[model samples]
Target: MNGSDQTERPDGTAAILSTIGEVAYRWTREGDRLEWGGDALALFGIASAEAIATGHAFDTLLDDASPLARHDSLLIGADHGGGVPYQIEYALRPSGPRGPVLWIEDTGRWYADGGETARRAEGVMRVINERHAREQRLAFLSGYDDVTGLYNRSALLDILDQTICDAKERDVNAAFLLVAIDDFRLINDAYGYRAGDRVLAAVARRIRGRLRDGDIMGRFSGHKLGLVLMGCDENEMAFAAERFLAAVRDDVVATADGTVSITISVGGVAVPHDAGNREEAMERVQESLGVARDSGRGRFVGYSPSPERDAQRQTNITLSQQLIGALSEQRLRLAFQPVVDIHSRETVFHESLLRLAQPDGSIASAGQIVPLAERLGLSRLFDLAVLDRVLETLARHPDARLSLNVAPETAAGADWLAKFAKTVSQRPDIGSRLIVEITETSAIRNLDETAYFVSTVHDLGARLAIDDFGAGFTSFRNLRALRIDMVKIDGSFIATLPTSPDDQIFVRRLVELAQDLGIETVAEWVQDEETVALLSSWGVNRIQGHLSGAATLSPPWK
Candidate 1:
């Protein structure tokens, strides 16, 4: 009754025997007491378990006159040296004459090498069980998403590939739909990120409830969702997409903030029976997504390749290469807009805006350079360049103050702080002169990353400001958390301020909030002299826009 007995194995050899042949008993085999299992002795009508071995009191059971006695010899011959594990189809004689000759299990083991072999066999069994358990876990994870227990992207791909193969073999029609969330960023911005995640889970559940038993759905990408619609046509797929959107609109996600509902934009393509492969099918669907996104938000578009769109995409690629050259060749420069002190009517900081110098000696403004750069995934490169140029200029112009315009995408991306640190380390004095400006559109979607980034940069002797403030859903809360150095009232709020009393009041309240938080404020898009005069009276610390006289770099803030 050591650990061995408790472990189901008896005597550190065979596994513990439970009930067998109705009557319960502990069965075991040993070289000396070969019948210690004892169940067999009772079945064979032996007077004693030991007598079976001695051939004395149970002699009749094996004697020539007794058929039962003959059967004992057969059992011994078939077992003993014949091997305990031997399988025989022959008859087994029963005891008491009434018990007919039964064809029995004949299952058990005898060891010539003692229990040493049994111990090794048990260890092998344990290893096999462990390996099998590990394999099952890996198999489950391969098909299931760890986050929400839906199928993962890889699983979806596998399902699509297998379904296509099956459809092809059977000469049947099959298709797939890829649904992408159009405004996931807006939802994430207005609600907390935790709320956004629950929305995704809720969307997944609603989709599942609507879909048939065989249909498969999963989160295709972060912020972009997708579904696989198979055994259907183009028209059938379109109908499913509409149903999916309707389901999502009806489903409300419960979170700490409350219940919130959202919508999705679907793009899909039918798998052609003769299409080259899965990649081609995916490309078709992705093309549809681009069309849906372009047409408007919360809509579905079917796959139809356009040559003009292809050419536009190619042009984008070409422009990206040209821009890279411009960056390296020092062909990019900054244009400045003066940020005037409201009460004193004197400039305090000149925001350094990016402008690319064309080979023909023409300067492309921030509107032209930044929008294109952000689209080409060069937002970080462009922002880092702007910061570097500002630092270099400040070294020579010590008396000059600095503010730099950064695209919203630059702050949302992962490469922000790493790039910022490199620039800051190179120019320590430039820190006080530099102010990093961000739009509400960019900050809203990726607030956590933005907060961490702004905090890190501000700690390193730089300033952070929310540009185009009050335009997005979460600007107020983000402003509180980011604790920025300044706020630039969006131009739209200012454009109508000269006539619209409501616009003027919004600006006043914003200024009051800034004062309470101990953060400065600026008014952007100050177009006319009248707007400038209005912003000044409304208590904006600085004004920047066309009224500041286009944009000049020679005198820095002409």
Candidate 2:
């Protein structure tokens, strides 16, 4: 058919298609001619429809980077008895030279003759610039931080890992530096978070400007940027760190609110020499950064191996491996300590404490393993393990009530809650008998998050309590915000409640305050009747210590 014959369509249908940025076209393979039925001029941003009248003329509009030529994608496919269908997306620069590029989704079917060669194809093309832009943005954000436009933490770590491997193979030295913006929290506090983000972006630009072509930088964490410098030794790492420090320190960052001056602390480690892998390199660089900050702000510290630190690191590594093994082998056990009612002297609940079972028939207390787990970012594993065991115990003994303490990280996030929600869904009845305890220090660290955690636990039919309550000196406002069911007074105050007048006064006031807020107070480390009497007189709800009982591995209910 001729171009004019293929251009005919119902007036209303043609109008609707053109209104929606769609154009229908018929291509004749014999003469390489193209016919447009809709508003081809508007869709292609051309002065007239004749500009794209032929297939060869239309090919000129296809962007050079288009994945495949239109003829190759549509005409080259194998023929079926019926018409073969195809769909493809490509960019077209239809406007005059230097105009914006337009993305189009073309879909249609082609009919082939008896020779199995395509003769003609008819299709519709729709403008898809917005969709293509969104996909491109998501692809960019997968590896880049949108805030500072630097590689994100995951991408940075991947680069660091590869760099370490490359350095080992090349037998050349390299360096990794972690740069932290000192007192960054203060900036966010003084200005708004948006201003703080501007400061980060400015600092990133400054550091990026100073980086060598071979070096790489990324947003490692909040207020911290990681750098990988190639062919650099320990001494060169120090020089690089100082240059970065000056890049951020020499000038002030201008935000919408005002100009703010900031300094950076840098920690550097020579790769393949001081650190054998990414994890080791990160650990040593972090330690170095800590030293720089400790010495003073706006300084750089190169990681130096110390006998004491090395021994401590080795011990931590061994302990972490053992902890992981214990978790996997089911050797991490829980010990129960009873919290007794002050007036009735009956058991209120048993607090579950974690204990490690050594292979040689020895036991390790939570005090020995918990702090290390928290430092090594393994507390969530322990939290989940303890949660599973607690649920199982509660399921076995239908009437047992147990309280379990979680690490600060667990309390701040929803991972533990997600685990609890899954198990509670199966054994919904066990939730009421479970009490989740968060340390006072952790609870107050982020009051809003803690309050949300407490609210969620209560919603799931479990009670929430603040453990080591008096230690953090939680204010009345924060306590009310948490809305916790109970508070366990810090053991330090209860251990000397009978002998120390100051402790007596503190404990008394704390108990009275908790009572006023409708919160039950439990005093810990009660060793004598005198202290119990004192606590009882002050209306303490419960007591847990030597006077009540010590935590034992054996189940109390059995």
Candidate 3:
């Protein structure tokens, strides 16, 4: 028989054009529906031949709105002679048991007609689709918020500027509203940036729901966002902002640790209605934000567009800078909190705390320095300075196994991690004795990255502890995944640990959970002996509170 006439199924289970090639067959049934053979179905994860014959093949290949179904042109080959032919790539997304993708090369017409038939029927998978997918991912990483899936500050401004310029030329009115989360940082401080980011993501979703079709919103800064209301009037703008605020108020962001309550403070300016330029509009909204913060948190302050408010904004900026400068120049000092191991009734370690040393020879708590530092955008720097004090004290005593308090914002910073690694590198000996106490919210900022860092620290002989557990939604997934060495029950939880049966039950369960994971449990703010006894009974491995003593050094730690 001639080569084509040698009717053969070399493999009894299936057939291919060439004995060496993959399975290929065409079946027509169910009103001209076409079904591919085993090779194509297998690429999509189909296990058996009988499965494809049962209309599964039809269910897998075509989608509801497939353009392929509507197009009338025959699948054709290029005008290539019988030499090695070139082929363009295509992707096949399956909708059934096989999984998402399969690629088939259509190399047929090369031999069917005289060489002029073109190389139309060639089957070879190319990397084009994969390459395009990678580019899309890159674009998202560079322009989007990983948590919220919205545009970040950099991407937001670029889009805003383009929209604004286009609107100006077209004589269109586009309003810009700046929404700052009221007490959002407090949530972060109380919870962790990881949990805080979840809240932001939830808030972003709410804003998107409230926006118009042409309008866009982006996260402008940590806890601050911007919305562009295109083709809107003063009244529409008002309605949208109110709509956004109302939506946010309705949200309850849950983290693995706990549920966090939050609210937003917004300031808006209807461009062309209130200001002539972007800078003026942004400044006016900023002033309005200042008004919102000053009046009381959790409310909206509409832009008034006046000189007095602008002046006040400038003054605040100046004061913030001065405060930052003072701290940077040896104006911050160290205080120590003696945390006793409740069961042992002995001081195991003193938590290295921060104090802003004033020129008046008075020291203020870190709680005082944080707001100013944040306003100055120097929170990371302040956190590092605190680390320095902690490290320096360890250098003095060398025997103290101390845990250091950390702020959420600082933990999320690349610079902080870089410096943290450097500090450890400089004093390798200190690594074993240090307990880095990070709040659940802070550690959760970027969970995977933070977990890797935690693992790295553990490798370096440093311990990782989650501070303020039960204050936010932190999960056992993270607890298990990260392998944290310690869990600090939030002081609020400890404060009511005995009085509230729910609290006692939760703490006991938490302690047992930590034990199962080989993580120690620490109770914070244990004020009295009764609380200490309760914590001890609950299996708290350590305790730190006022009863142990206020954080101090020589001079009342003040």
Candidate 4:
């Protein structure tokens, strides 16, 4: 008898395979005999080892009907005196002629040395099982959050997409609720990160308890939960939002520091009503969330798309695409508006305004076009384009000075600052000739960042101005903290300064405040000589508007 005919392994092959729950068997290629070295026969419901060894039971044990099963020849290089080891896996046919099939991984090899064969099979099977378990773990982690045990953001998005498709096919409604915990950052700030985590887990549990089994919910991001409700309209969604809000509003979450009661702001949007697609639905819900948070804490708002809002959204979408093309295709044109000395009436400098010329021979003003760029995160592109032109013009005329408007988003970014600094540093003269303007609203939004920008501008030999002064809640404390060169007073007060006594008082006080701080003031929208004279009397240093001159393509200094 050859080595394949051996029924038992005297070598150490049996010990290794037995430890890891693997069974071993041997087959003779010539006689077509199969024999088990361990309890492998019982796995296939064979009556005994004799039943397999006596007949050609190899074919009967295999499920040839299964498309996935492999029954290829086990004899590879077996015709010669020696052959390399090969393994095959197949499905087991029903035992009682009515049972379900079971897949069996049969890793075996022809053995000149049966001990080496068993050792190799044991090693391969162990690796296969470990790899299978590792893959399952990875798959689970990818789809589910480890902390809350909920579907993660990416998985939830897929679910939302599928739900949207299902709703479209069935002509039903779907709504998504965005739940945000109010003052969540304060919790993390006061207590440690551990306490914040406790609050988050508690909130998730409370919200999850209230959701129906059919509905789906997940942690959308930090301090926010997304809930998907099927067959819900705006009214029904409002009720659902109330329920979700009730879950977190009244309960006090016990943390390490103490107990804290939290409130949630919820915003929902209905599909095929408020929006047409998933992206639009998400945008509408986000807007609703903003409205809810802005209203107050512990509030719920359902998105109602007004005709004007819808039209504006459409226009923004169209203009965003156009803005991208404008930046890439160099279609942006610059218009110069002078900010002259209020007393001298001489061109002090030109403020570069951007204009986008459409393919239809229509020009869009910076006011109408730049906001779309800011929203789409292309403000830096627009800013850099204007900067390049300003640099070129300044290079040609050594005496020229240009003030350019920097979008709040662009100024807040480090990348833009680095590039801007590098370009200005190369020519120290450019800094004195350049004036960087940031809006009052933008300055107040992130005062520290804006102050740093001011310092950097001063270092680069450029001047910084707080544009649209008095437009927002401008604290004098922060205003004085910034080392600025100019303050362009907001145009609203100047528009009615001549007629409105109340405006006259506000303008007078504003100019006095700026002078007291030793900051130069430029009064904007000086439409007539009367308004200009009033501003000049109030000690305004400069004036900008139609009175100075309308923004024109031609350079005023020329």
Best by TM-score: 4
Tens digit of lDDT per residue, candidate 1, span 181-259? 6577777888877767777776777778888767778666675555666677776877888888888776666767667
- Model with the higher TM-score, candidate 1 or 3: 1
Among all windows of ten consecutive residues in candidate 3, which has the lowest summed lDDT? 118-127
| Best by the lDDT measure | 2
lDDT of 2 at 464: 88
Better of 1 and 3 by lDDT: 3
User: Against the true structure, what is every candidate's RMSD?
Assistant: 11.1, 7.1, 14.8, 8.3
lDDT of each: 0.67, 0.88, 0.69, 0.77
Summarize candidate 4's per-residue lDDT along 1-558 as a digit string, tens digits.
122333446785655665665656545444655555544544455555555562255566556653332324443343232435666544556364466565555565543334322221111221243454576679987998766778888988788888888888899988988989999999989887788878888888999888886899887888888889988988899889998889888778876677898999999998766777779878888899999999999999999868997798788788778788877888888898989998889989989999988888788899887776778778888998888888878877788889999998888877767876787777778889889999988998887899888888888888999888888858777888987778999999999888999989988998898899999999888899999889888899999999888998776554
lDDT of 2: 0.88
Give lDDT tens digits, candidate 2, residues 217-291: 999999899999999998898778878989988888887778999999999999989999999999999999999
455: Cα error in model 3, Å: 1.6
Where does candidate 2 stray beyond 4 Å?
1-176, 183-198, 204-240, 256-258, 271-283, 293-296, 423-428
Stretches of model 3 off by over 4 angstroms after superposition: 1-273, 282-315, 371-376, 555-558
| TM-score-better candidate, 2 vs 3 | 2
Q: How far is candidate 3 from the true structure (C-alpha RMSD, Å)?
A: 14.8
